[model samples]
Target chain A: MKLKSLAVICLGLLISACAASNDQAASSGSASGASAGSNSGQLSRDVTTTTSSTFAPGSQEELQASIGDRVFFETDRYDLSPEAQAMAGTWADWMKKHQNVQIEIEGHADERGTREYNLALGARRANTVKDYLTSLGVQANRVSTVSYGTERPDALGSNEEAWAKNRRSVAVVR
Target chain B: MARILKILIPLVLILSAFKPAMSQLRVSVEDGLREPLPIAFAPFVTKNGASPNMGRDLADVAIADLESSRLFRAIDPSAFIQTPAAATIAPRFPDWRQINAQALVVGTVGNEPDGRIRVEFRLWDVLGEVQLVGQAYVTQRENWRRISHLVADTVYKWLTGEKGYFDTRIVYVAESGTADRKVKRLAIMDQDGANHSYLTNGRNLVLTPRFSPSRQEITYMSYAGRRPRVRILNVDTNQDETLGPIDGMTFAPRFSPDGDKLLFSAEQRGNSDVFALDLRSRRRERLTDHPAIDTSPSFSPNQREIVFNSDRGGTPQLYVMSADGGNARRISFGGGRYATPVWSPRGDLIAFTKIEGGQFGIGVMRSDGSNEKMLSQSYFEESPTWAPNGRVIMFFRRTPTDRKGRGGRSRLFIVDVAGGEPREIVTPGDASDPAWSPLSP
Candidate 1:
């Protein structure tokens, strides 16, 4: 019985190993991801690339680098800060310039909260950004919102500094 | 030659026909073993061209399972005073008594005519000099581990007077990559961590997998469409569908005792509330209308009531309400915040995860939220699921990563409900969010 179980277990291990390697294959495109390629290659490479030379006057690259395509929020609270409000105003203006392009607003949260709550909090944060943009005259149809909760953190630590950076929402051009 | 063989066959049969008188000693569940019972596990004797080391290997798995319960200490085989000579043979109690073993397990493995393995084992009370129990099981060679679990369960129940949880499985999230960008996939494995397999390809994040009481299905939260939503998957068929275009993010899902309904938290415009949905009719009912986070809803075994975690009182705590969602009452007043409250199958206690003094631990309390006792503590531990018998809990523990959270791994652990050290459950990969399934029919 033990020999039989060992064979089954060995087969299971082999299948899981293959699954892990397949994940590596699928995530290998992330080696050139923005600001996340230094160590364990895991960050999504799904973000669109906008080179400096090919950057339009109001493209994602220019907006992200200058006006900031992201805004931070208080812990467990989705209200925008004064600086965040200013950034949101700039983001609205950029949306106006690129009216033809739609955007997805992703809300995120720190690790201190439960996954479900953080998800709701993230949605609130993303919607807060979207509401500010719509109030500033960007069409509601042009902006969609989703929350990743703490699943995709901008910073990866348990410390206050990392948590602060993680409790924010980013605007991705869709 | 035929006459000579007939004489030799009878001689061999008589030589091996050594069975002790059938006697029984009853052990009661009320007389729980306060200290780990010392037991000797004799290697099974193999015969008829069975794998030479099959008996020893089977014994190893049985010993590991028994020891993991923390109720039985498997005495090292090196100290064994006697060994078995054939299948269906009894152990000499005096030899086991000499080694200070209060209980002993002896077994043998042999190849059958139909290309299968037959395992037979017996449990003996050393001090009382009586046979406690015995059984023989025949199956394909590939099912040895299951045979081992059955053996452990038999031994455990005979000695402890409680149903054992060895023959069960756990579903969890298999995680990979750095902390910032984790790839979480839904995975399932045997309780002892064998036959590990991924249900999802990790294309999307999955969390909080739960098994249905009457179905081979799982309800969990997935970001498959890049949106947080409740999804159900048939583990056997690998088919899945989303539950609701629920106004917003839906998560922390659990199935009702009957498996016909599901309870989960749905957050719309930042207000999270618990809701129930009927599987067949696809009718949705709001269970909690609180403006605060009310998640982790679990149903009692009887399905008469529900226990969930809510932060409506400013801090996360446990609350109980009728299955119909009225007359809600707060039941937790412990020092720390509690979350992920799951009712036990035994219908007496609710298991929960506690956050106190900046550390996370697993604990249990009466169904009415009294007599709370901490079972295990660590840097990060949560998501306690009860074994079918409600005598054990399985959870996941995460190691602290660097200051940047650059590296950390999560693994599953199990502990007896009576409070003992949690032992790690070996898996092929980093794992979390374990849910124990009910005993298979």
Candidate 2:
């Protein structure tokens, strides 16, 4: 069983690497075409103008599209359901378009676990996302991870709805 | 000799008068003989050029500071008959005496010539019909809250014959979010949990924040940038500098008694050992060379010896060692795993968390780890911090909830080290990892 799981993780890594290479090829082609039209002296100034819209534009729309569909797991568990996998694909597609933009994936937990253990669990949750995104061909350096360890909450009520909303790893524009 | 005799005669008379009522006095070992003295806090009178609510605001803050200590029951304003206008203006003793009030606190909040608030108050012993203490302070309008706590501290010291804890602060970990994606931030607040401000942005997990002897700096463990290292943070400047980099995880940090050295545990491979780093020289010394886990090191009052927790003897127990890392001795022989041992500021005892039979408890023992007394028991409890006086301990407790984990709530609590009923301190959200600051000078 352990060997099978390891093989699955390796396959996921290969898929993510292939997808990342295809994205790089598309971006580099556009960069070369743009550079051919502008002289070297003017390229640096126009580069910022081109990359700003290339990276973060339409990010909010893409993030909103995945809202309410994703579900978080208990600490240290990374197996994704059909719904979460669908949401992860949407996030992966969003990253494919905004290749130049770096994002931070933050993981959080409720206040039931011990402090250090919760931190490690939050890290594992973030790493799960990072691994899945990497398998979808996103660059690892472009995605940083942080864990709040049950400190910041999106909802204030102590009900299930609040807990569900809080136990999530969010993709934030860095 | 004649002047001394004159003072001795009234002292003798007062002692004689109290002899008949001595048996009626019920003083618990924890709180001593004095009943929570009932004092009346009449709304301070506001004079010309002062803010309309200044008087009421000062009085309200003063009352809160006094009440938070679980001492001094302030009488309702409706119970007062007359208010004092000046120190020389004697209170109507009969009016207060009729309401069973033993002491009366009267004050005025007015504008001073220098554009500051001048608050003057007098504590009158209604039964004796004499003023026990009187003082005035000039401060900016924004500092009225601090002025109120100072006033309360003065009254507390005068009445109890001990210094007050009102003018202090607390550093703790404020928790939020869900069980899977939670965020913990390093937060500091007034002793009453007011004026709360976060020191870290919840980007990392921070724990065990200890105030320096100067109360200006904090040493805590943080996983910022995913590095489990110890860092020294200056509260005033918001500047943090990482201590010397060690190969493995470093945690369970505390300042030396003189605040010149920091003692903490550094986990290398899987073996954790106690080490001290000099703040000035940036030099490091290994205090315990044992193969067992040694953590939670604290300095004795003179900084010559250190007390810490170790699993060297098969179970986690308290151990003491010299500052130079020699002559180590096991101090705790009790049946439990003890962690987070903190030497009291008074240098008489060490406070720690004891785990026995799957239940956690807060307890204290003598310097040699004898006379262990459990002050509180709960399903989950850790981190026992002492108030400066060492009379009370403030720790975190979590209640067991239902299957949905709905009722599990973590809150800070304080209990007398003498083992009395514990009192819950209310906070907005779940709070934990409490570190009580030394009394502010």
Candidate 3:
């Protein structure tokens, strides 16, 4: 049986469960990512990103043109920036005016990071938008989220400028 | 890691050469990696009027496989004193030894009546003046390439007394189009880059194709129907199924050591956590529930513990916890962010992607987190996958993109852990996220 153990693999679940009492030896920290649990539900003043541009009301094009339905972030951060907070406020106001609109928040990241980590980071960004809008009275059911990780970049280049432009979250109206 | 999924095939042994006890040649795997043995090859000659190129092609492929292992050096055929036919009939040992050859390999290919081909090869210990191996394999003409791999693997195992990875395949993402809107499709090929094919069309995007450890299946994340979900694909049957009856976005998927479960990261609301789902029972269990991102989980070969990449440390780093998430301990203390921690098939080492000082590197460390050594670094590099034997790692490296924001030149590369320059595995276009399958028959 001892030799057979080397060839066959079972989930670590069984061992961890049986060794719960022994686990007290290695207590550790949940640390940094856990600190991100606090949601910034605070919505700032309404400041429309585009005042001159005209948009086709009641259309997906309006989300992109009139209100600038996107927010940007610093590298590896999901919290909405001051500018992103202003953009979120405008988005909440737009959602209130157009009650029929349902939005899918698409989280994206630049190519400077790893695949799985970037994916999780992207999800954090998307969820941050969802949380903000819901806190401002947007129905939770009206919002969905998906993360493209570093797979879909908005900018094509590898420079800092392109990377900055690529790391963003876009609210797609449905 | 070199555990092979062997399809039983009947091979005939024609013991017409010297007895085994007379062959005194023996080489350990350590010697195979360090000091390459010099051997002479006379291309296999054709008999019974088989395709003119079949014999020579077989010899070429087998020699190439042996050379790829970095265990044997093929002395130039131009230096051979005897013709291939003469060597196949009866090797002139004195002539081979005069050229400082430690070993000699010769073979023959012949046509079989039932629309098949027969290949026979002989390995001779030139110093011992004795035959080490002589066997005949009968396979369909189209499967001639596989037969060459079999020959290489057999010789490799017989020489070094270890499993051979020559007969295996690799799956990776074939990238095209612009950097922003790349058409990423899943592509697979032989270990040496032959018989290439695409698994998914570019209509939707796909990423991170991982092979099942026990079956001819793969799991990946696909952005189809406007959602990112974990998907399981049977390579042989072309049957794909969504991983769950449960929701949200799923990515960073990997199969358990036994291939009976899947470990992946899921995002619900705004948090990312690692989860394990039993394939047989459809039971889902959360491995790590810390608010910090816990992703890219992998089981040790023995299933006793799991290693993962997590950002619980503020920056991403490698962590090892009991397989059941009993307790977690950080394993990486290096001055960099670490991601994609893949435990070796041998359970002795772990390979990871390290990002530091504006550079990305591929490195390996002992399972206990000691003796970390970076094998290669580039402008951007990640996704280190281990060969079944755990002696080599395959990853993708991307050069900095151009001014137009166009994607850089990304290609797959392999490096020997024992030490050597990395070699590029060229595909039709840019390729990334390479996963190597166990040795297959």
Candidate 4:
């Protein structure tokens, strides 16, 4: 599969080089770019996990699919509520059941605050979840945290509902 | 020889007698005019038949720059009584004075021998019937627009006793798509909205592009790494370098006044702190180590202090500290949440965005956080950047998106810092996060 993808990339590069000399090369260039984009994602996934076909009972995929993988936060607040706390507890149990699975916690924010301020808010929120997991016996070394600030949003609307959904922390299996 | 000396001696005596009186009558606008000063602009004439019709085009650009300031009213050229040829010969003072024109601008454009363009312009005090300023510039033909701006700056400084911002450009985010899936590109254009070009393709989400003090470079936050981080781009060469391989997210990047360092925020383990990177030595220094979110830092023009926003007081408020991040004192004590504090180039005031009762507004306050005054109030507006002269501010105002985050539009707006109606700046598409550049040298 690796060889096939590499071959495809080379072919696309050759075609793009030829297309660059022509006025009608714009469409072909995007086609090659799109192929390269998906290939990179597939390559990264291949490097991370040995088994990619299905989610096992205690696997990270199952933790995300069947169990909760995210918890929402209120605007500008990093402290978890009762509902978010319960969700974090469920995630903690899953992490213990699958000791081999590592998780990265990503913090997010709504579009209200300034860019960097929201990034800090998201970082704080992600750390809150990481702290909760550690308290529940998930090893500190097993969890990593990063903040996306308000750059990525789960909801696009400007109303309260959208904002509430956008402010969240997600546990992604690594 | 005797006959010529007799005539020349009398002419010299008359001119010396009138010089002081003409100088005294030269208009010195001491304050903002209640009404824009009426001025006449005769179409620039081309010598040696350049044949590009650039003469009229260049004059129009200068006229637009003057009129946009809301300080000068360009009179209709058809109303002019002085012919273009006579304007070059002698001052038709009565003709301009009859039309109530306080000032007159006349210029000539021609092709130089070295394939360059030569532009010469003179500003006349119409009422006083004397020339105020005159200069000539030579540059490549493609730089005609810059020549026009230079001419306008000459006129502006002579009349207002203040520098003009026409020669500057703006770096901003040209946004498309909806709130949920936005495509933003770093775009730039002249102050008058000409020569619009995109620096980055919309492959990544970009925000808050800021110009370096002296170079053709910008620092902004981008998500190209799948995590938000600060990046710098050299505008001319299109080279981009990640500011830091920081362990966590970094955002809100701004160049120091000297362009030797950058200030931004970095997050780790749910704590956000302000950090400064020395561009020359490639070393990073943590400025603020508080558990609170400290970001949106701006350095004073003198570079001795910085103003930033922090939520340490349980709400986001403006704060000031030394350049190294010691001695932080809260500067905002208003009802609203203050964020995005930018120190004015003049160093007298700081502009910020305030959110109160779900309404966002732009405002200014003293450097010590006193004399707070709101400039514009609307549904959603933020990111206030000062014009080069510090006399005005430009920011973006976004209308609320629909339930699905559709139908939202963001437009740039400029308002006079001394208080005036906020006017929308026309962009080809939705725009936001405007950063005005220093006046072009």
Q: Highest lDDT among the candidates is held by which one?
A: 3
Candidate 1 vs 4: which has more DockQ: 4
Q: What Cα-based lDDT does every candidate model obtain?
A: 0.76, 0.67, 0.79, 0.78
TM-score per candidate, in order?
0.84, 0.68, 0.88, 0.84
Segments of candidate 1 deviating more than 4 angstroms: A1-54, A135-137, B1-33, B86-88
lDDT of 2 by residue, B117-151 (tens): 77778776777766666677776676677778778
Instruction: Kindly list the interface RMSD, in angstroms, of each predicted candidate in the order they appear.
Output: 6.3, 8.5, 7.5, 3.6
Worst 10 residues of 1 chain B by lDDT: B4-13
Models sorted by DockQ, best on top: 3, 4, 1, 2
lDDT of 1 at A11: 39
After superposition, which runs of candidate 3 have C-alpha atoms over 4 Å from their true positions? A1-54, B1-35
TM-score of 2: 0.68
Candidate 2 global lDDT: 0.67
Candidate 4 per-residue C-alpha lDDT over A1-174 given as tens digits, one digit per residue, 9 for 90 to 100: 222243344345444322321211123222222332224244233323422333455554444333335688767899987667766776676677667878888888987776667777888999999999999889999998888777678667787877877788887777
- Just chain B of model 3: what TM-score? 0.94
Worst 10 residues of 2 chain B by lDDT: B4-13
Model 3 achieves a DockQ score of 0.34
- Give DockQ per model, in order: 0.24, 0.05, 0.34, 0.33
The model with the greater DockQ, 1 or 3, is: 3
Which one wins by lDDT: 1 or 2?
1
- Among residues 3 or more apart in sequence or in different chains, the pairs in candidate 4 whose N, CA or C atoms overlap within 3 Å are A123-B270, A124-B270
TM-score of chain A of 2: 0.60
